[model samples]
Target: MALAVTCSISISSSSSSSSTFQSSQPKFSQIASIRVSEIPHGGGVNASQRRSFVKPPQRSRDSIAPLAATIVASDVAETEQDNYQQLAVDLENASPLQIMDAALEKFGIHIAIAFSGAEDVALIEYARLTGRPFRVFSLDTGRLNPETYRFFDEVEKHYGIHIEYMFPYAVEVQGLVRSKGLLSFYEDGHQECCRVRKVRPLRRALKGLRAWITGQRKDQSPGTRSEVPVVQVDPVFEGVDGGVGSLVKWNPVANVKGHDIWSFLRTMNVPVNSLHSKGYISIGCEPCTRAVLPGQHEREGRWWWEDAKAKECGLHKGNVKQDAEAELNGNGVANTNGTATVADIFNTQNVVSLSRTGIENLTKLENRKEPWLVVLYAPWCPYCQAMEESYVDLADRLAESGVKVGKFRADGEQKEFAKRELGLGSFPTIMFFPKHSSRPIKYPSENRDVDSLMAFVNALR
Candidate 1:
C-alpha cells in the first residue's frame, strides 16, 4: 500500500540568481526514500505556508501496480513502438512465454508487449518505463484451468500491460477434434497431438516475428539443458525469416526460479493464477493437471499419468535429436506444430468436457461479501495451529469493525473442496474469492503472536 504524506518544508530565496533556504521541519525517516516534486514556481511555498510536497514513493510510480481492473483487449494498440535499440534479453528460463520477450529485445523490434514471468516482471516494467516496445504472447494449449486465464487478465489490467493471444487455426483444429474428440492428443502420441494442436499454430504465430522467447529453465526440463543463449536456431523454422537464418530459439529464464517468479510477480503487482494458492506449482492443460504433494517436482502435477520423471513435449521430443514422424506418433498429425491457441485455455469456443472443477465451484462463497477474506492453512502448520488463537481474536476484532471472515485448512478432509475452492500452498495465505485479488495479503505474524496477527489482519482489513 502507498503511504501518502504531506510534509512541511520552509523555503526562503533571494530574488537574484543566488538563493538560500532553511527549514525547521522535522525530516521523517519515512520520507527519506520518497521522490520530491516542486509545485508551479509562481505559487511555490510561501514563506510560512506549510508545503504539501506530494512526495513520491521511493520507487517508480509504476513500481507498485494498482488493484486489478477489468481487462479489455481493445485497450491494447495494434502496433506500437517509439524506437528500439540497446534491447537486452534475459532468458534464464526457456519458458515459452519468456521466448516472446527475447525476440523483441534482440531485434530492436517492439512487439505487442513483452510476455514475462513474475521473476522477469521487474525488468519488464523497467523496460516499459524506459519505452521499449515489446510484445507479450502466451499460447494457451486448450488444457489450462481457469486460474491461468484469470491471472492473464490480472496481469494485463494491473500493469496496463497487454498479453497477445496466439490461437490455433480454427478449421484444422475442429476437423481434428470432431474426428478424434478433445482427448485426441492422448490417443495419438502426446507428441503428435502437441505438434498438430500446439506446435503448428505456435510456429505460425511466430511467422512474422523478429524473435520468440521461452521460459525454458534448463534445470526444469531436459530439453532446455542448453545454455540460455540470447538466441538459438529454431527447429521448426527450417526456412522462415530471421528464425531460420538467425538466432531465433531463445531462453531468457533458463536459470531462473519456479519460486522467484511468484515473488517477482507479487512485487510487480502481477496477478497470479488462482491455482497457485491451491498447491499448483506449475499450471498447464487442466485435464492433464492435478495437485502436486509436498516434495513433488514442480512439473509433476502436469501429465500425472505419464509417470515419467522427464517433462517435455513433441517439440523437444524427449530431448531426442532425430525426428521420428508417423512411426513415433501414437496418433496422427498431418504436419508438425499442433494447432493450439490461447482460446484453448479460455475455452472460448466452449469445448465441453468432464474435465473442469465445475459449476458447483462457481457457486462456492459467491455473494459471500464484497471483501470476503478466506484463509488457507494446514492443520499441522504450527503457525496455523497457533493461528487458531489469533484467528479467533482477529475474527472478533474484524467483526466488531464490520468485516466478514472464512477459513480453510490444507490438510482437512475438506481439502479437495478447499483446493478446488480456495487454491492451496500459496499458504498461511488469505484470499478474496470469486473476484480473485492480486495482492491478497499473507498473514505477517510468523511468530503467531496475537498482537502481530491482529495488526496484520486489521491493516489489510
Candidate 2:
C-alpha cells in the first residue's frame, strides 16, 4: 500500500548546470556548523538553511533532473501487507537500479533512502535515475568525522535536495557525557554509545516513513549479514502507525558487491566521503572507526577491539540471530558454552562483590585501613566482559599487596544513584579510594589492559 505525492519542478535559472552548481555550492564550514539540535525530534529541514541546498541544474535524460522533488506524507494508516517474501525472491537477482525503481513506485513518499554519507550515495543516484520523488534522511550522531560533514554538504549541492537531519535527544547525550565523560565507550563496549547516538535517532527517523531503503549488502559483513533479503517486513523497527508488521525494509543493493557500488559512484561522479580514499571502508562514528589493512574485511575497521562474531552495533541487531552460546543467561550476562552462571563469569577469588549498601558504606568511611580499588560494572556489558580477565589478573597480583580489590554491580536499579554519586557513566568504571581520604579517584583512560590497570592500582596503593 502506497500514499503518493506528485511534486512540481520549476527551473528558476537558465544558467549552465555545472556553473550553477559550482556557484551555489556552500563552503564545507558552513554546513559543518549546522546545529542539529534545532532540527526537532523525529527530523526536519530548517527553512533558512534550505537555500544553501538547491536543486541540481538541468541534465540529460540519463542524469539527475535539474528539478527538485518535494515529498509530502499522507495521514492515512497502512493496513495492507504485501507479499515481501515473494517480492524478495523475484528481485533476488535484479539490478540495484531496478530494485530502487520498484521500491519508489510501490511506496513513494512513504519511503525514504537511508543515506550513510558513504558509498551509499549510489542509492540517491539510482533514485534519481528513476525520476521519482524520494525522501532522504540521516542521523547526525555529533561524532562524525569532518570529511563526512563536508560530504553531506557536497551531496546537497550535487543532488539539489535538502536532507532531513535527525539528532539524538539532548538530555540523553548530556547525561551520558556528563556522568561518564566523552570517550567512555573505548573502555566499555560501543553498544551504549551507539544506542544513545546512532540507533535511537535512526529509530525516530524511521517512525515517519512506511518503508525505508538502505545500502546494505551481503558483502558488507559476512558474519552478520550473510542472509540480507532484498525486501522484507522490518523485524526491528516500526512505522507511522507503529506495530509488529507496520514497517517494511527495502535493500535495493542487497545483492550488489562493494566494488560495484564504488564503480557506480565513480561512473556517476557522485559525491562521497573523503575518508574512503584513506583506507577506511566501513565508516561510522569517528572514534570507533579506523582504516583497515590490505586484506582485512571492511567491518574490521569498526570497533576493531571487539570480537569478530559480534561486530554489529545495536542498529542492525535484528540481522544477527543469537545462538545458545551467544545468548544471555537469567542475569543478562553472556552464557558462554551455555553452562556458565553469572557467579562463574565474575568469580575472581580476590575480587570482592560489593552490594549497593556495601558501596554506600564504603563511601562513608572517613579513613580507610587499606586503600580500596573498586570497579563499577554491569553484567550484560560486553566491555565489562572484555576486561573481566584482566581485572581478575590485576586482583590476583594485588592480593598480596596492601590494596583491596572489589567490584560493584552498578546497573539496573542502582544505575541512577551510581550516575548521581558514584561516577558511573558507562560500564566498568574503576575508582580508587585512598588510604587517608574518603574521596575516590576515577580512572581516566580507556585502556583496560592488565599492565595499565596494574599500574593504576600500584601507584595508588
Candidate 3:
C-alpha cells in the first residue's frame, strides 16, 4: 500500500497565488528520521515501503523573524545526519524545481536563495513556481558593476519580492582600503579584499538561514568544483543555529549544465545583467572580472590576472591550499634583514633549529624514542608572525610530554635547502613525525592556537 502526502504552499505578491501538491511517497518527516547510510544509493524504494505524511503545524512568517543580526547560540540543535543523507537521496533524481519544492516545504521561511546577478537567478524563478514563502538575498560588494546593481532592481520588480541587500561593515571596508589602497589585490592577492567585501557580508546573511541555495555547477570549474554535490552540509559557515553541522547548503543545479541554465532563463523571460551581452560570461566585481576569449572557461573571465587555480574569491571553498602553495613558491618577497638569521629565528627555548644537514641526520636518529613536531616558516609571512608566540608557548608546554619540538626558517640561506629537504610549499607548514613511522604527518588544522596545537600533538601519540 502507498501513503499519500499533501502540501499546500502559499506565495503572496501584488498578485497572490496558492498551490497544492500531492504525492504517494514517504513524508519528509519519515525521511528525516531515517538514517542516511541505511538508504540504498541506486534506486527509489518500492511503493509498499512508503509512509503517510501527517500535517505539520504551521507558523506565520512574521513569527519566524530573521536571525541575521545576532550570533546564533552554540547549543542550537544540529540537523540529523540521516536527514542530510535522506534529503540527498530523495533529491538525487529530482529536478531543480522539485529540489526547491522540497527545500521550501521542509525549511519554510528559513531557507534563502543566494543571488549574485548571475545565472543563479534561475533558482529565484524555481522558488516562485513553488508558490511558497521564501527569502532572497545578495551580497552588495561595494565594487560591483553598475549593470549588476540595475539587474538586482529588475529582479526585485519582476518577482515583486524584496531582495535583501547585505552590505559589508563600514569600518572593515574603510580600514582595508586605507591600509592596502584601492587596488592592492593586484599586488597581494584577491583573498584579503574578497574577505572584507564579499565573504563577511555573505556570512552575515547566512547567519539568519537554516539552509541556502546557490547556483554552483560542477562544470563551471572542473579543477575546483568537479564533485559539487546536489546537497551537502556547508563546512565553512554556520546557519542561524550556530551548532556544528546545523546548516544545510543546497546546490540544486550542481549537476545541471551551463547551457541548460541559459535555456531556462531565456524560456522564462528572466531578467539578467546586461553585461552578458558584452562578452562577460562569469560576472564579479568590476575590477576583477573581464570578458573572456571564445575558447576560455567562464571562470577565466574572473580574476584573470592570477593563475587558474587561484581564481576563487573565498566565498565558496577557500583558496588556502592554492594561496599557501603560491606564497611558498617565491611569489612573495623574502625578508633579508641582517638582524635575524635562520639560527636566530629558530633559537627559542625548548625548540631545536634544524638545517639541511641536521634534517638529514634525523634518519640516523630513526631509533630515537620520542617523536618530533617540526614547523617550516618564513619570517615575512603574516601567518607565521601571528603564530610565532603561540608556537613558542606550545614548545615550552610540551617539554615534559615526551614530544620534541623544532623550527626551521625557510627564507634565508637555507631557503633552497628547506625547499629541497622539507618540500615546503607554504609558510608555517607543521608536520609530526612519530619515532617509529617512516614518514612525517603534516598537521591539517588551520587553528594556530596553543591549545589546538597541543591537542594535535597529543592525538598523534
Best by lDDT: 2
- The local distance difference test score of each candidate is 0.42, 0.70, 0.68
Model 3, clash count?
Answer: 0
In model 3, which runs have C-alpha deviations exceeding 4 angstroms?
1-81, 318-461
Residue 37, candidate 1: alpha-carbon lDDT: 19
lDDT, candidate 3, 142-247, per-residue tens:
8899999899998777777667778888999999999889999988889899999988888777766667888888778754676677777776776655645556
Better of 2 and 3 by lDDT: 2
lDDT accuracy of residue 38 in candidate 2: 27
Candidate 2 lDDT at 230 equals 87
- Clash pairs, candidate 3, are none
Please give the range of 10 consecutive residues that has the lowest summed lDDT in model 2.
Answer: 48-57
What's model 3's lDDT at 412? 54
Model 2, span 89-190: residue lDDT tens: 767777777787777756655578888888888888888776555667888899999999999998776777767777888999999999999998877878
Q: In each prediction, how many residue pairs overlap at the backbone (N, C-alpha, C within less than 3 A)? A: 58, 0, 0
Using lDDT as the measure, name the better of candidate 1 and candidate 2.
2
State model 2's lDDT. 0.70
Query: Cα deviation of 43 in candidate 3 (Å)?
Result: 17
TM for candidate 1 is 0.44
